[model samples]
Structures are given as structure tokens and as C-alpha cells.
Target: MSTITPHKLGLHKILKHIPLNAIFDAPAKARLAKAVNIADLRLCAKARAHKMVFDYLDAGADDEISLRRGKDAYSQLEMHYHVLSGLKPPIDMRTKVFGCDVDIPFFGCPTAGNRMFHWEGETAAAKAAEHHGSLYGLSSLATTGIAEIGEIHKGPKVFQLYVWKDRELVKEVLAKAKEGGFNALALTVDFTWYGNRERDIRNDFSIPPKYSVAQVIEAIRKPAWTYDFLSHDPYTYACINTDVPADSLAAFVNSQIAPEFDWQDAEWLLGEWNGPAAVKGVVRPDDAVKAVETGFSTMWVSNHGARQLETSPATIDVLPSIREAVGPDVEIIMDGGVQRGTDIAKALALGADSVGVGKPYLYGLAAGGTEGVIKALDILKVELDRAMGLLGVGSVDDLKKRGPGLIKRRPASVRDYPDRYAYERGYGGGVI
Candidate 1:
């Protein structure tokens, strides 16, 4: 009956069929809003940040084989799921870190120079940590000082110690950490020299950036990021914002960081802090045992996110052995190539008391500042809860109990040993 009559063209009906969502969705709230996962945030950051800045945050040591393997290794392990066997309701992620209860099993791992990424910087990350009921690791090279971070975040905080050659500066930093009420001190012990981060070399990256004309042109393309960079205070290492010359990160690291650091120095630093301490950058089982012997409260299994040693073993692959060596009691917190909730669960199941995430959170930080970091943690928490439910585990402890038996690594028979371990061990044992 309707076809009998000739109707005028109706703009309203045609417009309704056109789906205005494509025409006017406001470009997804700056793309950061569209990021539903950690990898998405990293992509968003890469798009927003200058290539050089992103490279500084992203690239690893020479060849970057270890860096690539750190993430690839986790993908080799598969988790077994149990059905209808989970606890009644409300799975818990809460756990203790040195007698202090933290709401999540993973905390933000410290990376230096947050201000270089965004104006909000460490403060943004610390606030997100507070909101998420987790800990924040403040770097000694942080743009925000310990006191400032301590003043803002009421949650668990740990100060990362670089053990610079300047002992008085080190003592002053310790004093500041104590005064700042940091719950723990993490001592990074793997920086003997700069790892040949060829990307940084190619970019000619530095702390206070020396902008080339090309870089300026690149910055012009990222107007929003450049706005934040120009409006914010100049980036400087807030922990020791004294007369130290602001130069290349490598130059400062080579000149200031103590290459002669040993166990005695670690012991003295532990004695000085006189609080819960974490010995970070340890990968060997023997080194794990030694860390326990050296009076550290926790052994942080890391390879400086593969920034220090290109040949370092993937941290996750070494975690099981470290756990066996350290026994049941020593808290093993690990960091490197953690991008997903499943990654966190996998690490927990492997006997990590807690996991540390650096680049992922930084990606979120660089993507949306404080809000982005909070969103990133929120995504992880949601994913963790879902994964726990699906895996039929009620708590972090439950995951730990189910972990060893359920998680399996890809067979070495099917794949080559990671390059670092490719040389078959005991090849000349009989001859020796």
C-alpha cells in the first residue's frame, strides 16, 4: 500500500540510516580513550610521542635479542584451566609485601625520568598506584623527588637506589627516603656500564634533550605532547637536583654510578636504610641465594628490563630456579616484559610473591598521564579477576598453588634454547 504513493525524499530517515557514529565520535577521546589493553596504550604512546622519546623509553641493549626474548619467553608458557572449582565468591588479589598488605599481587616497577614522558610524571604514576591499592617504585633518577611523591601518595612506596659514586649524595638520598616514609628500598646491582642501546645512540638521546631541527619538526607534529613538555618544569633528576651537570643519561650514568659496587657496599647500604630492602637485577640462582644471604628482604629478579645486558636470560625463565634456590620464604618480585593480566598470573604461579611492571605502565603514563596509568591498572585488575575466575582460583595464593602443575613451558626439543643458553652446557665437561 505504501508503494502506491510517490513520497518526497526524507532527509531525517536517510540521516538516521547513515550512522552518525562515524561522522561525529570525536576521534575516540584522543586515542588513549580507545586503548583497552596495555599494548594498545603502547601504540597510542608511540603515535603521540616523538620517535626519539619513544625510542628512549622502548629500546634495549645491543642487538636487543634479550629484550625481544623477555616478552617472547612468557608466550611460550601455557596455563591449564580448571572448571567449577573456584572459591565461592569475590576472588582476592591482596598480598603482603614485607608485612605490609598490598591489594594487588603486582606493583609499578620504577623507571627513571618520568618527566621526559609526560608533565604529570612520577606524581601521576604514584597517584594511580595509590588509587589501585598497590605500591609505586620511585627511581633515584625520578623527576619528582621522594619527599614530593611521599607527600602525595599514601600507599606503599619503594625507593630505587642506583648506588652512585657520590657516597654523601647516596647517604642524603637514603635520608630522604627514610624521611619520605618509603616502605622499602630497592638496590639495582647490575649497572657496570652503559649497555649499548643503539637506538639511543642513533637518536642521540639525553636527559635534557638537545633538539635538532628534525626533532623540532617531529615535536611540532605532536603538539599536545610538546605543549605539556614546554609548559612543565624542566626535566631534572629530583633526587639529586644539585650541581651535577645535566647531560646524556649514559654520560651521567657512566660518570656518577659506581662501577666498583660489591656485596660490602650492598651490606652498608642495607645497614644505612635499616628497613625492608629489595636486591633488584638478580637473575642467577646462586645470585638469588647470595641476595638472601646479603640481608635483603626481597630478591627482585630482573635484567634491568633487558636494558643492562643484551645477553641476559629472560627473567621469567630464570624465576623457577631462583624460587627453588631461595626456598619458600624469600619474597621474589620480578619485572620484565609483563604486558597482560595472564602474564601477571603466570609469574605469580611461577612463585613470584609479586610482579613488577615498568614499560607497560609507562606506556599508559605517556598515553594519558595519571588517568591513563589508572586505566592501565584498572584493565589489569579486571583481567586478573576474570582470569582468576576462569582458572578456578579464588586468590593469589590459590593461583600460586595451582601454578606449578598447570603452567608448562614449550619443549626445548621443539625450539632452540634462547641464544644466551644455545651453547649446550657440559659440552666439554669430561675434558675439563
Candidate 2:
């Protein structure tokens, strides 16, 4: 059994009390409905967290134009539906991911310092995934160690690894994960340098965020997250310390370990883990091609939740070409900007074998705990089933066909539009 699962009487019990009437009445539930209604989980999160955290989750490099475009691109494309499609009274949301069969096409992406949001941290996320028959991914920076979550949960698990200056540290963490029966080792490649998050700057965010008197009062309003947080001592948070060498939290983040990385280092990591090593943070077609050539079992595409690298390309915009470049043999997994089941469907339609979701589940963790996390996943399952039935597709195969037609090269007429039309039709529509 994996160590992490939702605690019913602890934090999740309150979730059972959330009245359905409150789905629209309660502020949190209402926002959850908004997220589920639009099939975008990010909406649920943006509504609740401190503006600073929201910006941290939502921002991207330079102007964030690509980030906006990434979601908007999905909006511009239309979904095709077949009426009276054979709708299973209830749909099957489970599928095979990596080498394990999860109940859904989703996994909890490893998120660090979860204690900042709730006391359970990795345990809540991992347990929720286990309950749903999914995989729980643990961050190298997580508050709850892999052992904790792995001990409590029975399901597929993944460890997100960051290469450090100390090779022994990397081996040590890997050994722990292996001992815990972790199934996959995902190496995050894009965080070679963290992104310029302006909101985090305003919040003065850190691994262990400092609290002001005002912050304490603000926390009092959300008793659910606060109580659990207080349940763990040390007042502030940060439970994961994998015996890696680092001085302070700042040093741990900035100078303590490796922030320098490249493809060669990644290939070496693949050899080191000597297991199912997936290259996370891949967003370019060429990079995806080389990832396979480099001998990775999967191309885990992401934009670091748009958290790192202010200049990274849109993970979604680059997915199609990468899928084409690598062909069907390679596994194309995606993350970033996925809030709804429809988002999951869209990615699958565009060649993603599956997706990894962040933030929204954290919202669930903050609002209710394990039950909240499970609610978040269950929300996605319902949304996905409805989306598939509406699209008139019967199964995953039907959904895969929906992929090719979803995106296409701009037609010359539409591409040129008024400018090119002006050139070709100038004699007929305007002065030569």
C-alpha cells in the first residue's frame, strides 16, 4: 500500500458535511461548481487562494501572452459531438498509465511544501489518488516523505526527481522511493532556473512562508486548512528533509543544490535510475524527439505549472508537433493549464496519453482535505464522462480520432485574411 490517502475523520470528514445546497451558496463550493461547470479546475483555485498564490500558479514569462493563448487556443477550437451516442449509464474513467492501471487518466503531480496549504501535505494527495485508483507523485521538495504516503496508500506512485550537485543525495532519494515501491522516476528538466513570479515577490513567498499578524488573522477565516496546519507542530511548515545538504530554506531553494542542468545530464539520469525514467518539462517538438532518441520511456511535457522559466513555450501549443515528431510509439504525457475533464479530453484528443494536474487538488486539500481532494478528482471524472458523451464518442479510441481534427495549419485564405486577401483580391475588392 502507498502511504498517502485521505483521512476521513481528520480533515475529510468536514467535506461530507458540505451540503449540496451549499454548492451554490457556499463561496468555496460555488467556485468549485464554476471550475467544474467550465471544465477548468484553475478557476476554482483562482477564486479562493491569496491573490499572491493565484498569480504564482497562473503567471508565465515576459507578458504571459503564451499562457493566455494556451487556454484560449482550446477555446478557439470547437468540439464535435454525435447525438444519442451510446452513453454508458456511468462511464469508465480508469486507464493504464506508465505500467499501472489507474481509475482515471490523471495523477497528482508532485507539489512541494503542501503543509503551507494543509497539514496532510503529500499524505492527503497520495491517499486521495490511491482511493481513486490513480497515481500519487511526490516532489523532491515535499513536506511528507515518500515513506509516509507510501506506507498508508495502496496504488501506483511516482517520484519527481531534481538533479542536485550531490549525486549521492540523488541516489539516496531514489533508493527511498524504490524501497517504498514507487513505479516511475520523473526528472523535472525545465526548472534549471525558476521563473520570475511577481506575485510571489509581493507575498514574499518561501518554502516556509513567513506570517504576519494580519496573515494570522487572515488564516483564522479558513479554519479547515488552519486547524490541520496547526495539528502539526513547528507552527509554520516544511516536513520533507531527505537528508540532502543545505543550510537555510533560501539556500535549499537557491544555492544549496543544482539549478544547472541539460540533456546530457538527463540522459545520465535515465541511466542512473535505470527504471522507467520520464523527462518532465519537455515543450518543444525537437526536444521531444531527442527525449525519445535519448532513450526515455516517456515524454512528460509541462511548463512547470508556468512556475519556472519565464521564457518557456506553451506546453499545449507545442504538444501536437511533438506528438507528430515522436509518432505513436512514444508516450506523450501533459501537464499545465488542465483544470477540467474536458481539458483532459482535449489533451488526449491531441495525442497526450494522459495528464498530470496540480493546484485544484490543492484547493481541495485546503478546503476539505482528503475528501476535498477526492471530490476534485471525482469532479473531473464526471466532467470527462459528460464531455465524452456530448462529443458522441463511445470510448478512448473515438476520442483519439477527435484529436487530428481539433488542430490544423491555418488555411492560406484564413491565414492571410484581409492582408493576403487584399493582395489576391485587390483588383476586385480594392484599388490595384
Candidate 3:
């Protein structure tokens, strides 16, 4: 090696330099400024939101095993490309979900109490969904009422129905959904009882959020979020209570959710809607098969984002078996652990008619309101288009036809890592 030269160092006379400029100049603004992906948005969202709020949004039920497994399963999957397979430019991401033609292969899954995340909340997400040419599921517990979202977003919309203790309340909400021109109704069937979301239990998070001393302290740290909270109409469950008091979410669930809810209730709701309807939380293959037999037009294969059961199977891992169970006729839409465009493609390849994203859009909403949501949608769209091109497919149909061959599943291997990182072989590895 040559000796290091330290003396007589001077700037080169003709050195070339990259001409740098502001990404957003004066008189212009950047929304989602540093976020490049949904994961980045998650970080931004965490930074913008209080710790309690972030935990409520990020944490899953019990040990969060399902949540980790869901994400890990996606990581283990590898997609193969058909090199130079005569695929052309302008890859199509458009398809029909629940009889509505969409520009993308994904939709925003319904999440309750949007204003709790941000003041713009459901309306912003609805608008972003429309802007990207997709559907937005408005929650029964949405901060904005059905009529308002319906009036604003002209794109396809779905209303998530939770059977309540009050029959009249359920009927009233369904009628409003129909009047509001909702394209379909997704009947949520998983929450016979609330999951043990320990984050909420520990944080003492409540709907029509009760700000505890800890929360108030957190609010002071996140002053921007606090300002928005104060400036806007005080947070309330716009759909259910204008200002009703409840002991806790678990108590409210016990009081409101119909414990006796069964297939008969599902049938009644289906008949009441008398339109395209989906069973929202079918996890087992038999249940998926039963859903079709029960006259449901679609089966939303989900586990409530792993918020219901910690031990439940990852949605993607169970998707293929469910597809085989339901056969080719019934539509299957999946949600949970979708954070990338490749994740969307993987779901489609595995036989999902369409995918639903909840936390990704929520992250976007927490990061930058409507623009952030739009950014999240746009990012996924771009990633999907690029992934399609790389995978040597042009249309959604082509993707479905070749998906099984192009995608293969395998368990994550210890040998994949460096030897130092690899602890032991076989059974010994488990202990490691």
C-alpha cells in the first residue's frame, strides 16, 4: 500500500459536482417528505403520533405471534420472473373488486375511529382511495358519518357492518349505507368477543378516547398532534355515540356486540343488504366454503389484522388452502401484513381477488393526512406496476394464470444466514 498523503491538499480546479436543489422549493410544500415506503411511513407516523396512539395502532393481540408470522411469511416467499417473455410496457393493475372496476389491486380496509388517528381521518382516506381509483371500507365506528363520506367520495365504497346488541341500530345503519350508495356490505363475523389487545389494556386506550394523565403527558410531547386534536371537533364515535359513556372498550363490546350472533344473523344481514356482500373475517377453509354456501358473494379472508387471535394462521399462509376450499367461483379478498407492492402481487399470485390494507394507510394518515394516504396508495401502485414488469406479466389475468409457477413457498432456513449468525443445526437450532 502507498503511504497516505496528508500535506498540500487543495480543492481541484475542475472537479465535477452534483447540482443539488430543494426537493420542495419555496411556495411549494412536501407531504410525506422523507417516506419512501409503507415502512418509512410507519416510522414517520410513530414520530408524529403519541406513543400510546402508535402502540394502539401498531401492537397486535396477546403475544403478537400472528402479526410477526404474517410479516415473516411474506418475507420468506420469493417471486420468480420470466426473463424476456415478450411482455409489453404499460402493465395493468386494474381489476374489479365486488363488481366495481378499480385502477389498483388493493383497497383500504375499514379501521374504526379514524379521527382518533388524525382529524382528517376517514374522509381523507376515502378521498385518497378515490384519487387512486380504488375502494374504501367505511367502518361502523367511523368518525365521519356514511352520508358525508358517500357524498364526498364518488368511487366504490363498502360499509363494514358489526352486529350490535340493538337490532334497530343495525337496521338503521344498513339503511343509511344503502341510501348512501355503498356498493357492498362487508359483515364482520370475527368479533364475537374482543381480542386480548394488551396494548390497549396497558395504555387504557378507549374509543371516544379518554385521555389519561399518561396520555396527556404524551400529547404534550406530540404538540402538533395535540393542536390538531384541540382545533378539531372533540373526538367522538360519530356512528355510534354522539357522547355516550362506556367503562372501557371491552365493557362496551360486552354491552353492544350480540353474543348470540350466528349464521342466522349473517343471513338476515345478507338479505337486508340484498346486494353484493362479503363475510369479512373467514379464517378457516371450511368457513370460507360455508360462506359461499351461505350465499355470501365474497369471502374476505382475514383475521382482523391479527388483532383478534395471537395463534391464528397468517392470512397469506392460509390463503391457498382457503382458495382450494372455496373453488374458483367465489371471490376471495385478503388482508394483513401487506406493506409492499410485492406483498400485493404475492397475495394475487396466491389467489386473492384483491387485497385490503389497514395499517399501511393508517400509517400514511398518521404521517401526512390525505396527501400521506395518497402517497401510500401511489407508492404501492408504482411498486406493483414495476413488479409486474419485472415478473414478465402485463395484466392481472396473466398474473393469476402464472402466479403459482412464478411464486414458491418455503420455510425460512438457518443456513441462509452467515455461520456466526446461525446457532445450531436441526432440533438444536430451536433452543438456540
Candidate 4:
């Protein structure tokens, strides 16, 4: 081997080239640039947000078995890569979701109280989604109003709706969405009542956050987040609170959510919107069929991000059957535990018309605001393009057409053998 020289090694010179002032001037961009994956973004978010805030975004329902399993289920299936298939660079990721053209197969899932995660909030995330040529969903409980997000994101946008105890309130929000030029309505049917999220209890986390001495101490540790939170407009449920005022999120859920909401209410809501509509929180094959019969244009295969149910099946595990139940014509938007671009491929290959991601984008929003959200979308888009190229597919349509042939479920190990029956039943190794 030739002897190494100081000039050839150049290890010391590497540090000199790093633009230190640029990094200092734009710390958020610097921090986001370092994240290579959704997991890295989560770590960045954890570092920036207070424990209570971060946990709220990160944690799931009661044991969080479903939450952990959602990501795990993606690993259970293996892709069969094709070699020598004549596929070229720049794989086409374009697809129509929620009646709007999108450049990618995945869209942002509607999540609540974005302001709690960052001051830039829903608008920042929406803007990023717009930039990526993907759809952004605004939650019924979003801190940003419908008009605001509509104004910012000119691309396709969907507004999530919860049928409230007050019918007029429901109609009012829908009217605003129409006026605001929202593209679709996603009626979330999972949260009849809030699931037990123990982390929130342990931390005493609430909307309009109650600052105890311990919380104050924790907030002080994250000075950047604290300064941003304090400097911004006070956080509220900007859409619905104008008509129905409640002191706390728990109270709002208890008093506002119509526990008696049924399929009739969903049908009624569909009639009212009279546009592209989706029934979110659908997982069961039977429920998927019912959603189609109920006049929904799409069935959003979700378990509320595993937040509303402790042991619900991972969305991916149930996607194939749901697709079969709804047939090829009905659009299926699968959401939950989509942390990788490979996951997006798996969902499409298995039969999802499109995919929706909640935690991944939220993690990005918490990490670096608008740029962070854009970074998260960029990471997924690049991974998807590379994954498709390697898998010998040139377009999302081609991936979907190949379908089950491109992927195979791994044989159940001894640990997973006992739950094989449940998995076959699409229950994610647990009984319904």
C-alpha cells in the first residue's frame, strides 16, 4: 500500500469546509438536514420538544401494542425484487388521492392540535405538503382554521370532520371547508370516545397546557420551543371552538362528540358535503364494504394511528382484505405505522390506492417546522423512487398492477406461529 500523506488524508480540512456560520444562522435547517430517516426525525423532535409534548405525538393507546406492531407488521412481509426488468430512472410516483392529483403515493394524515407540537403548526405542514405536490389533511381539532390552511396550500387539501353533539356545529365547519375550497372531506369515525393514553395522564398533559412546577422546569430546559410557544398566538381549536367553547380537550371530547353517532349520521354528512368524501378509521373488511355502500367515495383504512384502540390490528395487516372487500373500484387510503418508503411500496403492492402518514410528518414538524416537514416528504419521495427503481417498477400503477406477486409474507416463526390464525383473520395476532 502507498504511504498516506497529510494532504491525501484531509481529515482536519473536512471541519474547515463545513459552513459554521450558516449552520448557526439556521439551526433548524441544520438540525433537519442531519436526519436521514423518520426515526432520525423522531430523535430530533424528542430533543426539541418537552417530554409531555413529544410523548403526546409519539405515544399511543393503553399498552401501545398496536402502535409498536404497526411498524413491526411491515417487516413481516418481504419484497421479491426483479432483476433485468427494463425500468428506467425517475420512477413515476404520481397518483390521484382524494380527487386531487399528487406527485407521491402518500399524503399527510389529519392529526389534531398541531400547535402543541410547534408554533408554525398546521400551516407549516400544509405548505410543505403543497410544495411536494401531495395532499395535506387538516384535522377537525387543528389549531389553524380551515380558511388559513386553504389559503396557504393551493394543492389538494382534505378537512377531517367529527360529528359533534351539535349538528349545526358540524354543518358550520363543513360550510367553511366548502367556502375555503377544500378538496375533500374525511369523516373520522374512530373516536367515539378518547382511548386511554396513560402518558398524557402521567404528564398531566392537556390542551391549553397546564404548566405545573415540573412541567415548567421541563419547558425551561427546551428554551427554543418555549420561546416560540410564548411568542405565537395562543393555541386553541381554531375551527370549532368559535361556536362551542370548552375549558379542556377532555371536556370538549366529552361534551361535543356525539356518542350516538351512527351510520345514518355518516350518510347524512356525506349528503351534506356532496363532494369527494372518505370514511376514515375503517379497518374491517366488512366495514370497508359498508363504507362503500354508505356512499363514501373512499375508505381510509386506519385505526386512528393506534391511538383510539389499544390492540387494534396494524393498518397494513388488514389492507389486503379490505381491498378485496371493497373491490378494485373503491379507493383505499391506508394510514398508520408508515415509517419507511419500503412501507409505501408494500402498501401499494398489497392494494392501497394511496397511503397517509401522521406521526412521521408530525415528527418533522416538531423537529424543524416547515423545512422539517419538507425534509420528511423529501426523504420518503427519494426512498420511494429508489425502492421502485431497485424493485424493477417504473410507476405506481405498475407497482399496483404487479400487486401480490411482487411481495410475499414471510413464514411465521415459532414466536409468531401461535398468532398465525389471528393474522389470517386480519386481527394482527389479537382477537377483535
Candidate 5:
């Protein structure tokens, strides 16, 4: 029989309180005040949001293997902290991305349909980003219009574009982005087709969400969310032109994708914008290289938050290779599974110019509106500052200069090697 340790007893006691204190009826501000970290914010959001809405924000493609892996990859890294290096107060976390200075190395990602989560929607997120002086990304499928977001967020903004079957519509949107004072363009390339999001399917989730009997019960359970949703303007794809009609909103959105889009087409779009642009979903080294050649000023290394592909490698795991492929000059923004300040530091140390976050801020938005979002950003900023101080670095550039020397992959656990013979033979029993 195995012996029980004091640490184990302590852990068990902590676990017991989790369920006992699972309160969801508190006011949004009160609940948000207790959230000291992104994970805490996530819990608050989960308690406040409807089941379908929470799942839509939280779940990923099919088995969610990529989502799990993306987070696992970050957790597997061990930082080589430097003690007694005499780092001064107020660590410099500021960095420039897309030719705009940001107070932190983190930025918001372009997530669609924010209104489903909170009535304030993208405007709340934009307000939080502006407050933090972090870049904000506006999705093509945003619940708020492009011009409105641009007018609201005075800080740097990137307009994420999805190529549509209608070229004229695409041009019109791009023109609108330019007029709205968006600093740059991010052409998202990985979403040629929607992934099989089983959670959404199971919940019967849709744009302008339709509630079934079970979902109605769920809405009643989350009375605060339901009340706010009902009292607000009816949810619609506020960014898309209303004239385009289809059998269902989902069908219309899905049918808008130009499946035959290619590098030539991407180049054409780049030419059309003729300004600072990033290719937002390049994961492969070869693809990263091609993005630069095709005139993209930055390569956004992402797997669409692990929402598009099931088994794709974590964005952090691919950052170094993409950086090497694109050389030192081309900017790289690492996205997906960034839950901590350490994750941001690790990405910068691995060669990312900046990192983009999607679910964290969205979780914050759901938990406490703009206040929650600001808290989420503040948590990351504080964490990153602490990490930089502990790492004996003073600025973002110093962390990047130290590079792989400051962090390394943790060795695989023995349990990961069920086939010991294969491991000894150097043939496939290790973690990928």
C-alpha cells in the first residue's frame, strides 16, 4: 500500500472546498474581484455563462487534442531562472507590434460573436485593450461593426479578414477598415473550412443562438446572462451586410468562404491592402517563409486557437522554427494556449515578437464585462513583469536576446514510455 503524504492531504482539503464554494449567483463585479488569475476568471465565466455559450467560448475541434496539447506544451517548459542578478524595479514589458508601441507583449485575438457571451461584446474587449495599451484585433465576424470598433479603440488595432466568395464585398470591408483607422490587416488563412466542433454541435449552438428546451432551462439557470442577452439588441452578425440571405445564418457564413483561395489570391489581397499586414495562421516553416515572400510583414503562428485542426502542434512549439524560417527581421506573433505571464515570456524568449490571446479575455468579458477583461490583461501584465524580474531580464529585447538559454523543454516522464524497449531503441516512445 502507498503511504499518504501531508502534501496529498492538503491537496485533498483544497479540492473539497472547490465544490463547496461553487457559487454562481454573486454580482459580476464581486465575482470578478475574486479572480486573481486567468484560470480564476475562467471559472467565474463558466459559472455565469449558459452551457452552450461557455462551451462555444471554451471548446475546440473534434477531440480537442490540439487544445489540450497547446496548453500541455507550455506547461512542459521549465524556465532557467537567474537569482541574485540584481534586476531593478519596474521591468520593461513594452514592445512594438505592427509598427505600434504596446505597453505589454500580449494582444487580443480576433474572436467572433462576442455578443453571445456578453451584451457589451467586442466593444468591451476593445475598451479593455485600449486601457492596457495592447493591440486589439477585430474579427470579420464580430458582433460589432468595424467602424464602431475603430472609433472606440484609440490604441493600435488590426482588422482580421476572411476572404469571401464575393470579391466586391471583401474590397468594401477592406476599404472600411482603412477608413476606420485600423493600423494593420491580419489575413486569417487556416480557416478554409470550419472544424468539427463537437461541443457546439452537441449544444446545437448557432449564430443568433436558438435555444432548445434543455438550453432554455440552462438560460433560466444563468438568469443574469439570459436577462442581459434578452434586454439588449437582438444578436446578429453585426459586421456582415444584412442583404445576404440564406436558409440559415450558419449556412450563409459557411458558404461565404472561397474554398479555392490560394497564394496568388493571398498576394492579390495583400496588394489590395498595400499596407502593414500579417498572415495570421501560418504554422509550417515553409509556409512562414512563403508568407514573407508574398509581402506579409508578419507571420502569426497559430492553429486557430486549436479550434480548426485536431492534432496540430502547439503554437509555442512551432515559434522557433517559424522564426528561423522567416529569419530574424520578420515579425512573429504566437497565439493559442497562452494562459499565463510565463507563457508570454516563453514566447518572447523563443523568438516571438508578441503573443495573441483569445479565450482569456473572452472569459474575462463573460465574467465581468469590461472590468473582467481589464483584470485579465492586468493579471497577464503583472505575471509577465514578475517573470521578467525573476528571469534576470529588464526588457522584452533582453529576454529575446537570452533566447533558448533561459528556457528548455522538461524531460518526458517515465510513465510516458510504456514501451521501454522502443524508447531504448530511439524509435518513438517519447513525447512529441
Candidate 6:
């Protein structure tokens, strides 16, 4: 087993000089999470005006156990320490995903109807990604088209695909994404019928939106988000709206999206794309392997932030084995529950090539716009640096070799011990 050294000391003392205070507790603001998480971010969203709208973003299918589990999954993994490790030099979160290199191990998942958040909306999120040196996945369903974000950010832009009943729409999006200089495409496979999001059911949040009296009252609560939201250009991506010509986001999603999508669709789409496409919404090893055969350059394991389906109760709990199945050659990217830097280390050590973080940066976007996004990335990067140093490592590459064997799994993670700790399972057993 490797040992800890004194070189790992002073992570906190050093970060003290870096000014995390501005990120977490801006001199002018109160609790940022409360505002961003509740009001400006979600609580005040037009979704609140209509339950259907809320369900689209806030609720989940069935009992929402899976949605709840996604958050809990992160809580289940505990971090251990190597007290005396010599982690003197700073740790770098920098890594290469797909072809382009990223400043950190995390990236942004493409979101739709961003204009609903603010006029700057998708634009704000894209700039935030560039400023942080991370990849931005733009949704085909985005209120903003691929070209807008692609032209703006020089780093990396990944196009997110939603399989439509219209093969023409699918091909058009691919051609547009390619034309716009999108590097890789990620296809979301799990959502057949949009899940029954109870919140949206209650709020009736639509594309153009049908604001109710309560929604108007709800919008009035968050002054800042409301102002920016109303200031935008008619506030929607006509690029997507023109495709469905539906009056509501819900109607468009239901009418145009295909629920009978299968693995064959993956192969067909791959033939059309002619680029390094990845399959999003993967969890099991069989599916990962199947996706690999379907012509995906990589298999991304995610629970769609537990927003789309409720079938799998958790995502993080299953990554270690997915790594073993895909092996080292195929890239494995995961998201859903990466609140801390240590969580980033855990995913990499388990064999994920990289991960996509959703809510954390979304919260940042909601809180302070572009600056908030920067702050969120700063928090994760700082934590990653400190955790790496404490673990006595110098780089993300080195940490991949450092696993539970380097230090004991914290007691809280004991129930997950059998699977997460046994990393040599090869490709058959989940225990790997």
C-alpha cells in the first residue's frame, strides 16, 4: 500500500489566500444557495406558475424515489484521508475528454428552454463554460441553436440529441450540429415518454408558457431572475419551436419525441452522424457494451439528474462496475451527484474517464449569472486541488491509480464497500 507524507500538508492554509469567500459568501449577498436554489433558480421559475412546467424540471416519474436516490447516491460515498501523505505540489483538475482538453474534470450538461431562466439564458451558461475551460453540451431542444453557442465558445461544444419520431428532424439536427462546428454528439437514449413530473403537472409550465395568476405571483417573488427573464428576445429558441410548431413545451415534447426508441435507432443515428457520438443515459454494463457496438465512441453513464426517469434508484453507486465493463479504452463519463471535489476523485479512481456535473453549476448560473458559474467551478477546483494534495497526489492521472486501497473507505460508505472497493472485477462481476 502507498503511504502519506508531510508534503500533503497546508491545503486549507494555502486556499485561505485564494479567496473562496467571494464565491460562497459574496460580500454583498446573503446565503446564495437559498436564493439560487429556491428563488432565482428553481422556485421562481415559470414552472411554478404551472405544475406541468415544474414537473418538466422539478418533478420525476412515479414516486420520485429515483429522483431522491440520485441526490442520496452522492451522500453514500464517503471520503477517506491519508494523514501524512506528501502532497506538496498543487493538484491539477485538468484533463482530456473526447479530443479537446478541459481545464477541469467536469463539464456542463445541455439544458433546454434556457431562455426561460433568463434572456442571457443559454448565452450566459455558454460563456460560463468558456470562462471555466469546460465543455458545453447544447441540447437539440435548446431554446438557443447549436450555431449560437458554437460560434461563441472556442473551448468545446457537444451537441445533445433527442431522438425524434421525425427522422428528418434527427438528420437536420445532426447536419446543423456538424455545420456549427460541434465536435462530438451525445445521444440521450432513455427518455421514451417524458416522465410524469408532478411539479409540471401542477404548474403547467409551457414553452411559450401559459402563466397563471399564481405563476404571476410566483414570478413576482424573485425580482432579479424575473427582470433578466423578461428582458430577452421573445425568450425562446425558435430553432426548436419551429420544428414542432406546438403551443407548449409539454405538447412539443410529447408530440414530436418517439417513445419506441431502441438500440437500433442508435446504430441508425450513428450512420447519419459520422462523428464521434456518445450514448447518454447509460447505467448497466450490458447497455454500455451494447452502446459501444451501436457506434458510440464512448458510453456515458448518467441518470439524467434523475429528472427524466425513475427506473434506476441511483447512478453513482453503479459507476465502478461500468468502468470495469467498458474497460480502459472506451471513455466513461458520469453525472448526477458531484457536489464535492472528492466525489470527482472517487469517480475517476473508479475508472470514469470524466464526469458531467449538473445542479452545482446550474445553481451557480441561477445565483450570480456568469460570475456565479465561475464561482461554482472555482469551489470544485479548489476542493479537488486540496483533496488531491491531501491524498498525496499531483495530478488527475496519478489519482486514477490511487483507490480505496490508498486509504480506508470512510465508515459512512461501508454499505457500498463490497462493490466500490473491489476494483479488479475485470468485466463480468459488478464487484469489480
- CA lDDT for candidate 1: 0.80
Query: For candidate 2, which ten residues in a row score worst on lDDT?
Result: 423-432
Q: In candidate 5, which residue pairs get closer than 3 Å at backbone N, Cα or C atoms, i.e. clash?
A: none
User: Which segments of model 6 are wrong by more than 4 Å?
Assistant: 1-58, 207-209, 238-247, 404-432
lDDT tens digits, residues 19-130, model 6? 4434432421443433322123333232222333334545556766776566545546555656766666656778888877998878778777765544456777889888
lDDT preference between candidates 1 and 2, better one: 1
Over the stretch 44-140, how does candidate 5's per-residue lDDT look in tens digits?
7877899888988988899888877787677677899888988878898888999899998898899887888887899999999889889999988
Tens-place lDDT per residue, model 4, 87-197, is: 777799999997678999997888888888887899889999889889889988888888888889888888999868888888998999998889899998898998899
The candidate 3 region of ten consecutive residues with least summed lDDT is 420-429
Per-model lDDT: 0.80, 0.66, 0.78, 0.82, 0.82, 0.66
Q: Point out where model 1 deviates above 4 Å.
A: 1-28, 242-248, 413-432
Off by over 4 Å in 3: 1-31, 207-211, 241-249, 411-432
lDDT of 2 at 105: 81
lDDT of 1 by residue, 101-173 (tens): 8999888888888878777899999999999889889998888888889888887888898869988989999
Tens digits of per-residue lDDT, candidate 2, 1-432, equal 522323312444554455432232256554454443322334444444444444554556656554555554454445665676667765656566777777778777887666655456677888888888887888888767676777877788878887577777777778888888888889888766656766666666543334555555644555444444334433221223545421134456665346666678777777778888788888888888888888889899898876666546667667888899999878778887665677788888888888888866876765445656887888877888888777776666567766677444454455422221121232122210
Top-down lDDT ranking: 4, 5, 1, 3, 6, 2
Q: Candidate 4 at residue 258, lDDT? A: 84
Give the Cα error of residue 271 in candidate 5, in Å: 0.9
Q: Give the lowest summed-lDDT range of ten residues in model 4.
A: 423-432
lDDT, residue 173, candidate 5? 88
* Model 6 alpha-carbon miss at residue 23, Å: 22
**Of 2 and 5, which scores higher on lDDT?**
5
Comparison by TM-score, 1 against 3, better one: 1
